[model samples]
Target: MPIFIDIGAAYPNDNRVTLVVWGEHYDDFAEMINAVDHGNAWLSVTSYLEVYEGSLQMNSDNGCDYTWWTGVG
Candidate 1:
């Protein structure tokens, strides 16, 4: 089965963010996120939406949400 990860932003606030990594193996998803170094960014988990598998989706009320899904063909 193909693995999948769904990450979504909960609130508009920078602190009220949510990051979820789901896939056939949780470790893979976690590793991907950790590799990105998301902690360096100013935006919190709730600032955008990210999905790994096919495409990446990002939404923000402040007009600064950015998401990039690499290694997808």
Candidate 2:
């Protein structure tokens, strides 16, 4: 299975696009963001989205709201 990471805007006041990056491309993704920030004088440090390395998994078995079911019995 491929791993995925969630990335979202660091600041709401600035217009930005939230995206998910493949784990394999994480370095490239972060580099691009940095390049844009460095090249643009108007863009502030907080204008970029932060990458979340981890996620919370919710499952129905323990009072969680989510459930994943395989069709096999």
Candidate 3:
């Protein structure tokens, strides 16, 4: 069982990083980042897959958690 999510612009830790995915989907997001190398170009896409493990909650599985901070300070 794995969680999947679409990578998008986020202000987590003030890094302004994209979405964070777990399991086998991490690589996909990484690739997008590598392709688009520009000023805030990575902060464009939005997440699509919202469901997590058949639930509406985010579970912190150590470092395997697919949760990314999209909150504003």
Q: In candidate 2, what are the lDDT values of residues 22-67, reduced to their tens digit?
A: 4554454455444444433222122233433343221112221111
Q: Could you tell me which residue pairs clash in candidate 2?
A: none
Name model 3 segments beyond 4 Å from true.
1-18, 36-40, 48-73
Angstrom error at residue 25, model 3: 0.2
Runs of candidate 2 with Cα error greater than 4 angstroms are 1-10, 39-73
- How far residue 11's Cα lies from its native spot in candidate 1, in Å, is 13
Residue-level lDDT for 41 in candidate 3:
36
Output the number of the lDDT-best candidate.
Answer: 1
Ranking by lDDT: 1, 3, 2
Q: Per-residue alpha-carbon lDDT of model 3 for 1-73, expressed as tens digits?
A: 3432223333322323334445555464564434443333323443342343443322223233222222223
lDDT of each: 0.39, 0.32, 0.36
Instruction: Name the better of 1 and 2 by lDDT.
Output: 1
lDDT of 1 by residue, 1-73 (tens): 3232233333443433344443444543455555444433232333455543434543332233234454433
By TM-score, who's the top model here?
A: 3
Per-residue error (Å), model 2, residue 55: 18
Superior candidate under TM-score, 2 versus 3:
3
